[model samples]
Target: MAQETAQQAPTTAHTAPARALLPLILPAALVGVVASLVFVGVSTAAEQLQHVLWGPLPDALGVGRYSVLWMFVMLVATGFAVGLVVWKVPGHAGPDPATLGLDARTMPPVVLPGLVLATGLMLAGGPSLGPENPIIAVNVALAVWLGRRFLPRTPGALWPVLAEAATIGALFGTPLAAALVVSEALAGRPMRGRLWDNVFAPLTAGAFGAMTTTLVFHPTFDLGLPTLGHPHWQDLVAALVIASASAVLGMCAVYAFPYIHKAFLGLRHPMLMLPAGGLVLGALAALGGHLTLFKGLSEVGVLARDPEGWSAGQFATMAVVKLAALLVAASCGFRGGRIFPSVFVGTALGLCAHALVPAVQPALGVATGVLGILLAITRQGWVSLFTAAVLVASPAVLALLCIASLPAWLLVTGRPQMQLRDDGTPIR
Candidate 1:
């Protein structure tokens, strides 16, 4: 009796009123809140472990926390741990993280445990990657698994969209980013409804997701740079130069990605490849200092706080090292995403631009710099715009970014994406 009733819930969430989006509202909002809860749980656990690994453990041993030598030790150890999970766990931690992006697909319920373990370790272990990719994967997997078990009548396809939107909203602390990304994904696909109607469910999920995450985390993206009241003609010129150059630099990384991934994969085992990548990352951390070590959100904050402290050369080196580390981390079997570390690279380069040309407003420098690098790497124009604008927290920066993004987009449009391809499909 319960089994039959459970098997049949609401009507297959397929039919909707032509004018109103009502059926998806409650389920999607609930999914969004629950997704944010999952994110907060995983991140909190990772942070606790991170503190232990980088703090008391080092102090007890009388070594400098996050020191050059300690970084080498911890990073190698972390690689070993993640490698073990990838090798021994089911689904091999749900595909090589190097091959994934915002479009990471859902996985089996069996794969979720190992995926969470691997991603959590990557986050705590200081692999220059972020939680965005794997968290999305995790949420999507869970949403599908649980949604089917409970809400069997919901259309199968809607689960992925709701999950992805919710995760993006939770990760960025704003539903707007999710809305833009979903809009981009929706375009060019044959669909039944109007754009706004189609987006209605995702927007609801994103709103709830963002709201829950913000209530829990109090996250903010602004950098506290001196605000620009109005855009200057020179600001446009400076933004153009910075954005274009940053895009080229990002392209260089994109070009190098396949070679790097091939080199690491050539090792033929997660154990050997990941540890070797760790050694290289240790060397990079030494050159770029501790700020280049982690996924880079807090480190970026530090950089923004003391923008004038580092020399231009120093900032440039940090940018290069972080970019290199991002490449290595992504290529070598680590379970994480590239966006946060890429943002750090852009931030450092933007600061370098400001250091070189004091005439450029620091906000404009960083915003355009981010715009260019994000465009080159993510190939998501709306993400590049949203993330960069959030950095400056200025409406005026948007105009400059709009102009600067034109050239940056041109440089990156025909280039290879940062991920390697597999038989025309993105590797899963």
Candidate 2:
């Protein structure tokens, strides 16, 4: 009877953990699905707005007349958004959309909604931020809330890990990336043999979320490549060189971006800061002849679609102007993701490279350069490469891009470690 009772005790203890996980897992998955759907809806809305507003706004703004006013408007809008976030949200806002690198576990939940709303505004209002990071942030927050509500007795760690993975997977449209992000976030933590089991629920949840995203909305960019001309050894070398250069630039961006953000934060009054940022943005927009006003995806598309429209000098000028505008807007407390601006910079750099190295195929050079910048700045190597390849419809170019991105990656390594609190604590 003693031995039987002992065995029963062990069984009871073992069953408890499994049973505890059940409630968390199921609710987490449902939350993930809902979050993904929300992301799809938001992304779709943003894209449609971009299309509708792009042409009309520019024409109405009348290039020179609107530039200053637009800048001021952007600043005011951004300040308002930031104020809302700071006042209402718990974590002061969501994740830094620019410095994202699989660190979701440490994220706070209260800032999710504000981040989402702010990001949507940024995107629709013509800021350079992307929708992906905000989407992931909201999803993770929602998952945590759902898990806590449903499984109050479960371990806290499980929900975050699962939620982050699911959200990342759904955002990236790839389970592999999501899994990798989760692994990175959980790095240094001691999970024992339970790590794999814990991830299982998240991975399943992520898969469900991704499927829902796919069914509800189509990706804005085509993620495919077609056969293209063979890449030469010289092309490969050029790509490598370009990739290295991009990485270096990326490192600079990562390090400088925070400071830029800080400058905007330092502004005591939103009324002054918003108008100032908008004015600067407008002046910069004038340099690009109105091309620099919006989120820059359309501008990138224009360059990609017609590589010859702008001369080398024009491309270089535009790239510099866009970068300056992005810096100013971001620094002035403009709410948005940095992804589109980075892409704009990459595209301009690629165009410049094509002009400098006439031996390289223009399309290939542009594609490679863009990919390299994406890899370096975002640290999302595969996604960047895929985006570049798909935009050009060329596998050979992608191969070259992959080779070139190495140096950029090497140069930019360890540059984005800077972290600052609202009161300037310098956390990282």
Candidate 3:
């Protein structure tokens, strides 16, 4: 009876934790809302700055908005400015960005400003990187500092999870992606309760964060591709082939990453490395065209909107060029994320497939391409699958993506990932 009672105690206590977590819903929601607002705030500031630099200033100077010379000038100037921030700012903008990932680390609050500055400059300066890494770091740091000051009773570890989930939720404009990603991450850790129980607060935070971003920003991942109906057996084959091929391409970039970084390291300083990278990027821009610039989201839309405008050769060039640009930007002391640009590379590659084999559906090619490349680049399977499917927004495509991800995942698995440690070794 004693043994049975003791076992029963834990079962009952488990229920208590679940109930205790219910109260956390309020705090979770609050944190989610605030974190999302921070995302919005930072993104808005960057867009405004980008407009000033590329729009009015260029127009006032009588230079074409996307002319090669202007691109060279802006890219060089942005490199120098960001280099100054990294060199002069405390904490060196919180370590080499190549050493970071989607998982957030709490940093001293003072590092946030410099981090934001570098991130903003990179965003506006035509780097083939996204805002995910720094933005997540910023949100996590803020949540940790504020949570410790205001709610001392909360477990010290929860703040990072809450903030990370919230920021990811805000980033994708959907709680589903955040919940899926956080669940994958948490599943690997030792836990005291049911997986769902541990996830409760973080899920709430993701929900509120996604909701806040949706209400405020109205962002959409759906590319409005033509509705995909029932899939054929050939569709499965196409998905597999395209995804596998895209993963192989991403692996090429992964292989080249360390060498690229090593080359930049020879330049020996941020000032020299970034400016040199900017010049190379300008040359790539000339070849890849302006659409290969920036984070690749809107540019991808433009590509999709007018698929007939580009030939297969042009599509292939854009993919290779964008991939190279991403490698350069990430390798050369830039502060940003690679996911968005990788999506563009995948998009172009997928379209190239469609152009080469007219029987391959354009929409399916694009989705599978994104799935494959993201699988390699991020190694976050669920989020990669989600991002790919969301682009097409078809239940049919999701079915295909699930099958597509398998081969792609195998190809990327155990390969050298694109990221490197501070000491320059692969993190794997």
Error of 3 at 290 (Å): 0.4
Q: Give per-residue CA lDDT, model 3, range 115-230, as digits (tens).
A: 99899888988989999989899989988899889988888799999999998999899888888998899778877767778778888999999999999999898877787779
Q: What is the lDDT of candidate 2?
A: 0.62
Model 1 scores worst on lDDT over the 10 consecutive residues at 419-428
TM value for model 2: 0.76
Winner by TM-score: 3
lDDT, each prediction: 0.89, 0.62, 0.89
- Candidate 3's displacement at residue 403, Å, is 0.9
Model 2: residues >4 Å from true position, as ranges? 1-28, 45-113, 152-155, 183-199, 223-227, 380-402, 418-428
Arrange candidates, best lDDT first.
3, 1, 2
Error of 3 at 270 (Å): 1.4
Estimated TM-score per prediction?
Answer: 0.94, 0.76, 0.95
Q: Any idea how many clashes model 1 has?
A: 0
Poorly placed runs, candidate 1 (over 4 Å):
1-20, 423-428
Candidate 3: 10-residue stretch with minimal lDDT: 10-19
